[model samples]
Target chain A: MPSQAFAPPAFADVLAAAARIAPHAHATPVLRMRSLDALAGCALHFKAEHLQRGGAFKFRGACNAVWSLDPEQAAPGVVTHSSGNHGAALALAAATRGIACHVVVPENAVAAKLAAITAYGATLHRCEANLAAREAACAAVGQRTGATLVHPYADARVIAGQGTAALELLNAGIGLDALVVPVGGGGLGAGTAIAIAGVSPSTRLFLAEPAGAADTAASLARGARVTDIVPETVCDGLRATLGAPNFDILRAAGAEAITVDDAGTLAAMRLLWQRGKQLVEPSSATALAAVLQQRERFAGLRVGIVISGGNVDPHALYEAGALHGARA
Target chain B: MPSQAFAPPAFADVLAAAARIAPHAHATPVLRMRSLDALAGCALHFKAEHLQRGGAFKFRGACNAVWSLDPEQAAPGVVTHSSGNHGAALALAAATRGIACHVVVPENAVAAKLAAITAYGATLHRCEANLAAREAACAAVGQRTGATLVHPYADARVIAGQGTAALELLNAGIGLDALVVPVGGGGLGAGTAIAIAGVSPSTRLFLAEPAGAADTAASLARGARVTDIVPETVCDGLRATLGAPNFDILRAAGAEAITVDDAGTLAAMRLLWQRGKQLVEPSSATALAAVLQQRERFAGLRVGIVISGGNVDPHALYEAGALHGARA
Candidate 1:
């Protein structure tokens, strides 16, 4: 809560972030599915951020944060503690800026994701597989190398950059009545909320969380941050604790939260793959799953769902798909 | 070939096809990949026809052919003998026209594809698994119900309509040095050749074929059609013998034919899935595989590759991906 001492990202910052990242980021396509619309009883506009650089939307925020640094601050490098899309995105963003990047990854991080981060030319600093150890390692790297530490979601610049995705969607002239985004560390959710407020005030914002990791939903219901719970879902990208600043913006905007079980999320993931012709991770599928679970609330409304990322491990996807298929 | 006696589809017909199918068919996006470019040493522009309605470029031709029928002819509806993307495309196109569609699918056809065709409201008639039986069943359906038979690829209207994809690509102002398309039944390849000749005549045309189904390469080499060999590749959609009219057009265009082995096609399919974040079938992967396998020829050139379709069975994809991963 002490993070409240720092200002949250404003709507103007979102505009600036959009302009800042415009030359580097992809203007991802918006796809429509008639079958999905018929099934959900609503028109669905999918923002394909899975097609973003580094195979995720994380690049937008990383690019913004890296570019926002002053010459002196950027001279040494940038550092982050992530073993997932954020790490890879930050590495790529640093590469674009022609600066050094050091990622403090946990010892047991997914090898595929780690390979992607290293492939983007980031130096890897391994730490124990826990939050405290990872943070200590990241701090040590920053202290030793004079690298600026960019918190994955809690940072204002990162949130503002992530908001540009929704900014582009709302500006595309589609009259979406609602926008659904997956809530993890709440960067994308908070960013989307701010963008919707600035561009299309009438567009309702909804945050989708995995039922197994419903910290965001619990936090919203309790009117307080929930950080002590352990996440246990197939959506590996969405297991982070909610960021205080992100929660502040989301709560202030009166964004609603919905929880979907892993089964429902997997089904939605399969639909997106089978009918939608897009490869997105399970975390990205949660937004659509939440919408489908609450069909009556969204019936006849035009909705935009952000596909967060597509850096899925093929083996994991295969196993999950097989289990889901057998159960079906 | 006697089919050469019939007038081939002209450049004007491609224009007409573009206009005719504009209201119904999606003008799929053109996707570029920097990583793919770096790996292949070529600037690759992918025509994402895999994202087309019914999940393939077959929809364009099917829509045009179905719409080309006059009121009297359309009254009885259109029929096709296919158990692949073409059947599904034709069924959906007929649905748009509010006409009955009869698909003569083989007995051992892929169940998923058959389900797609029937789900689009087509009447399915099953026959023995062979070309003769499929054609006989199609003929019987035509005689029984007075239905118009629409060939999958050989028809002039179909080829013209298929050419619209290349037309749109060339018209997009990107000066492509060459165009590469998979030569399954030669529908897309011939259409692309005709479009290139009409719009960007200097852009060379290349036809990619799976080594297991390298009939096109043999045909081009021997200056005669090679129709006796059986296709044994993972590219199920390309198993059909090349149609006479399609072969004639491709041959006359002086299009170069290249062959890639199944291993290369599978690897390329995985690359498209893992790196490109697009779900493309093996047949579609052949184009990129050919480019990669023949990198010496396409180095530093800007090439347009058609991702022909994306309607893949998840089980098959999983198995292929697992095998490829194990091999890697």
Candidate 2:
């Protein structure tokens, strides 16, 4: 399918995605931490996607995409280019359908993530640490195996599937004033925007982005796609440039952006682990960081923060002394 | 209350305790980890006491003990000697009833645990690392402040309160062939024994103890309480000698012991964090370690493992290189 042919996922797609992925995906719990709420000066409802299958929200989209494929389309299997969580999620999703999975992983990917992708029985193709190289490697694998390519966050099905998390949250009747989600390729943010618009129109959407990889923020600021910067951040999951359709959807939904530095993200991650007892990765922490960084804006509001994933290397984080300080 | 006059907590007490604590304590979720089940070759139901208020199963007992107090008794507040979790739990529980709480903490307790105790508005009294010093300090505090002593595990109210966790697990309707819990002061284990006896008589009970602090196992083997050995394990929460009443209750229940070394506990802790997405402390990991260590005994059986706590210092664990390698 060509990029031009792709349509932006609507709230209806999210509803369908919820029903389609119900059998395979986990309806992760919404956790409330009083300590966290006290710190943020808001009632925070945390959608614990870190506890989802494959230890991330990536599973929802991966499972939806894999199962949505017809028998003939799925016969050749599925392929994707991912630095970590999506690769493992897609591999696990493909495994559920007993189909082959090919993942093009960048050279600089975390070792623990590579181990997980392999553990999930994906055929990994190593590529240079660049989008061009990753895409080329993925295309070559697709050509060879006739596998259908599942773009990490750009695809409509993936965006719709990612929205199910927000749908579930809204369905819980938490009456949130605003929702915050970390934006990488913007699947979760765009999907969440659509879900909030349909189910709770009064709810506002805030996209959390790492300052080092703040293309989404830049895009939102300039009212256009921004894909030129070289990403630099500890959040391995939030390094991708905002995808075109994702940008369009987010812009259309009037989503706001909250950018957090690496220091803020690390501190928030530590707080989540220590106080919340939830082992969310740095990418997941960005959502909390955003809420905390802008406390004045979120004060006394019922805010929802989506913990995007928990596929981190504790050893690596420890080695970096990321867990040493009490900043947040 | 004199030791000679005190009776072991019975099923009736457990029922009463549950009712008393229902308003204060969380009925923690029963989580299922399929990967963990596959690894252990059994259906594993994880009683997530780590997510309990004050980050441990200790809250149930602490809350019950505080609420069970008469208004005049509660007015003077409560006091306890604890290395970690119980202190924080008691402090938090006391805070709920707007009562003063004094915690006698050993010098060598984890810094994070100390922070949690202080965070919960408890007055901390530091003592030497010995059990005798801790008790002396606790008694002195009680004498000076007119506070009621809430023993970590020895008191009937506490034991009954601890039983509520297992009661909730049993109430979840997940029929299990066996249940596992880390044996520290044995409050949780003793309580669990009563719960199992009352709710599911056929369910076997297994106490997961640290080999370096295997007094519970020693007491069971010798058919008497043994409080002589110096504990030398990394599991901060499981270093206590078995309480006398706890021993008596376990002996009556014919509970089995499964001791795990520090290395096994560390490995299992890492696995729980990495795969189970639960950042459990070493004490909590012992239950999973026990299951993994004695796989054959639990194979094909529906097993319940109570994750005791999550008050670990990630910085300390990392500095000690506890999260370095994979051995499980």
Candidate 2 colliding pairs: none
| TM-score of every candidate | 0.96, 0.95
lDDT of 1 by residue, A1-328 (tens): 0112457888999999999899899999898887899999999999999999998899999999999888888889899999888999999999999999999999998787788899999999999999999989988998899999888899898999999999999998999999999999999988898899899999999999999899999999999999998999999989998999988898899999999999999889888887787878899999999999999999999999999999876566665552357211
Can you tell me which runs of candidate 1 are displaced by over 4 Å? A1-5, A320-323, A326-328, B1-5, B320-323, B326-328
For candidate 2, write residues A112-210 as lDDT tens digits. 678889888999899998889988998888888889999999999999999999999988988999999999999898889889988998999999999
RMSD of each: 2.5, 2.2
| lDDT of each residue in B1-328, candidate 2, tens digit only | 1122578888999999999989888788788887888999999999999889888999999999999888988898899998578888999999999999999987887676677888889998999988789888988888888899999998899999999999999988888899999998999999999999999999999999999999998999999989998999998888888888888999999999999999999989998988777888999999899999988988899999999988777767766888788321
Q: Name the weakest run of 10 consecutive residues (lDDT summed) in model 2 chain A.
A: A1-10
- True-contact fraction per candidate equals 0.41, 0.47
Per-prediction DockQ? 0.47, 0.47
Tell me the spans in candidate 2 whose CA falls farther than 4 Å from its real position.
A1-4, A107-111, A326-328, B1-4, B106-112, B126-129, B326-328
Model 1 per-residue lDDT tens digits across residues B1-328: 0112346898898999999999999888899877899999999999999889999999999999989888988899988899899999999999999999999988898777788999999999999999999988998999888888888998888899899999999988889999999888888888888899899999999988988988989888988889998899889888777878888898899999999998898889888887887878889999999999989999999999999999876566665453357211
lDDT of 1 at A267: 87
